[model samples]
Target: MDAYRGFVMLLMAAELLQFHRLHEAFPSSVLWGLLAYHQSHVEWAGCSLHDLIQPSFSFLVGVALPYSLASRLGRGQSLQTQFSHALRRSLILILLGIFLRSTHREQTYFTFEDTLTQIGLGYPFLFLLGTTRPRTQWIALAGILVGYWLLFVLYPAPGPNFAYEAVGVPPDWPEHYTGLAAHFNKNSNAAWAFDRWFLNLFPREKSFLFNGGGYATLSFIPTLGTMLLGLLAGQWLRAGLPARALLRRFLIAGAVGLALGLLLDVTGLCPIVKRIWTPAWVLFSGGWCCWLMALFYGLIDVAGKRRWAFFLTVIGMNSIAIYCLVHLIDQFIINSFHIHLGHGPFQVLGPAYEPLLTGAATLGVFYLILLWMYRRRLFIRI
Candidate 1:
């Protein structure tokens, strides 16, 4: 399920990027719709389909936790051994995330701010917390969210005064909070220097001590909540409930999550903002994750529809490979081939065709490579 979703997301991203590149070649609405779907990340505030992507990834981590742990336990692994394994896995993921973040033309060392790193850093804490009784996990999850809210809300710097009063503040106030956090953490990329200078009140030198408010920190709390929910779902799924019962539970949970999120947003206690990973953001994004899981569970596990599942399963099975491949392809292969469609034998095609045709061809080539690997049973795991 995880690999399948990841593959779908990657293809969606590629299709969106392709459509964006061909905006001028297609109808305005079609182009704009694709662009909107691709542009899922919230600009600085509020929720969008784009914002759901990362949360979905985190949610899947949670969903898989129960099954993975049970399998380990079945193998006669002690609790400590299982935990050690989880910790090791988390560390590897974090390192990989750091590798991705620092894989720049100029960088030579790891950085700890990327999504994978955040997940890697966050997951062990979650696993440790989750290993307790379910009720205890729920309490811990709630405690984390409430504690985070209190910490940021009452924190002397970056809240109420600095965040509330900042002029021309980005819609996502959390970005400013991250700036404050980056100041203290001093783990930021220089590429974002201009963004820091203009949006944040304190200069890098002065406010370096106060940099930890944005989505990254909030992620610590709400994401834990997300993982908790996933754990809960995993537990429920593993309890041998009937398919209909599971589906009903998922729908009910999703509805409740969405309702609570909306209510919180309406009350202004927590705005549905992804950049900040606000509490409302948690419920909203989590609702979507639940819905997707329900749908997939029904379609694949319940319905026994395995034909279409293979594609996503392949990508899912070797998701990390696919992610790295996509990135490398975009950075090196596709960019290197500046096909001049209007020259020589390709003279008939215009400049506009270059982006569309080239992008399609490149994507097709990569997809085929993935397909071939899948057929040959060459699943890569890390």
Candidate 2:
């Protein structure tokens, strides 16, 4: 679990690399093109390596929850106390996400589209599902996806006059999408509509229009399904199944999810979009997450090859702290390196390499902090 979570955090923290800069610096470089594509979020209705970060994080939260609950119970805590802790954790996650988003704003952002906030909103329900039997949990997952799909399909599609530009969607965008699929078009879906009114309920510097990226606060609904999938995986892990059996199950589940998600997308039943956390996306990304868990579990826990994962486990151990630190103090760390190490060191390779150099320094600083915390057995969890 730590290794998997750490891998996700490492991916998140790697955003400091500014892949676009590299791409711009070497537009014709095949390596940069590939890196840029994987690091950046897809504009709409598709997935990328970067897109998996949030799902992985949310999925891991589910993976960790059963273990967390068992630990609490083992400590003699009552159910009420566990509920209180879950509630408190949920509140903290939401507030932390908001606070992070509002860092430079004059007022609260009132947006819940971030992975943290989405997880926060959905966590209580995930906790409830966590306590249910696997069959019950599967039912809940299906219900949530079907209910959300119905909400989109049943809701009236935006009329022809809908202002796609206002939401940063080009008029001719997504050339292949039409008909029912168009209902879930960027910034025109039911979730986007909900945010139009929902975000406005809070005080805002401007009237809430549409999210430029087509993200919606209600994505937490399906995000819970992603987490529920993780919870099921966690439960399987705890069942003491044979290692090969466990790995096979994860691989088979991943294949099923991937195939099912593609079927939905190809059939136009649902588009596999990560931006909206579409039901198809839940399964698609959940499949990848399952495979990742299998790989990590097999290599580290099952095969007993633990040393290579040490670096990732360090960051994973203090994942929350690194999450906050990267967002909050990234610039400070980068600037500090410039002031202390001097520009000569970073500029040695040439000015084109500056972003990469500085990014490396900042990432190093972040990892060192995590390493220190790990060595001292200090993990900050919400």
Candidate 3:
């Protein structure tokens, strides 16, 4: 779990790499183009490596819940105490996410769609569910996905004459779905309408408009579904199935999830939109998360390959600290490098490689901090 988590955080920290900078430098290079694409988000109704980051992080939260509950109970913690902690943690995560979002703004951003906030919003419910049986967890997951889907389907779709530009969608946006799927189109769904009203309740530079990226606070609902999937997987891990059985379970679950999500997308019952955390996306992204867990578990635990994962374990153990470090001070570190060492060092290989090199140095700085914490056995838990 630590290795897989470290891998996820590494991907997040690597955003400093800004592979997109290579677009102009290697316009025709397929590998670079793929790298650039994976490093960024698709406009809508599709997936990318960047897209998996949030789900993977959210999924891990659920994956850890079984263990979290067990550890607390083992230490004689009461259910009331656990509930209080979960509640407190939820508030902190939501506020922290808002704090992070507001760093560049004049006031608190007041958004709940951030990865941490999304997890925070649903964390308590997840904790409550943690006390239930595995059958109940499965039911909760189904209810969330189906209920969210129905809510979107029941909401009125945009009229033919509706203005797309009014909601920040481009005039020529080519990803718009037609027919039933139109209900899930960007900035025009039930979630968007809810945000238009919900977000305006908070102070802002201007009236709450559609999110430029079409993200909505209500995404936390399906995000909960994603987490529930992880919760189930974590329970499976705790069940102590033999190595081969666990691998088979995860592979089958992953394949089923992928197939079902794609079926929903192709049949137009729902579109897989990560921005809104659609039901299809819950399945699709969850599938990938499970497969990742299986791979990390099989290789690290089953194959006895522990040394290779030490680097990731360091990062994974300090995930929260690094998240804050990267968000709060990554630019400072980047600037320090350019100021003290000068751009010449990063540009040694030519302008095309400068972004990658500078980013690598910044990432190295992050890793060193994490390594220091790891060596000292320092871990920041919620």
Model 3: CA > 4 A from native: none
lDDT tens per residue, model 3, 52-111 = 999999999999999999999999999999999999999999988899989978877889
Q: Rate the local accuracy (lDDT) of all candidates.
A: 0.63, 0.90, 0.92
Best by TM-score: 3
**Please, what is the TM-score per model?**
0.79, 0.98, 0.99
Quote the lDDT for 237 in model 3.
92
- What lDDT, from 0 to 1, does candidate 2 have? 0.90
**What number of clashing residue pairs does each candidate have, in the order they appear?**
14, 0, 0
Ten consecutive residues with minimal summed lDDT in candidate 2? 174-183
TM-score ranking, best first: 3, 2, 1
In terms of lDDT, which candidate is stronger, 2 or 3?
3
| Tens digits of per-residue lDDT for model 2, 1-382 | 9999999998998988887788898899999889889888988878899999999999999999899989998999987888888899999999999999999899888899998999999998998888889999999999999998998988777778877788877877853367788778878888988988999999999999888778899999999999999999999989999999999999999999999999999999999999888889999999999999989999997899999999999999898999999989999888888888888898888887888888988999899998888888888988
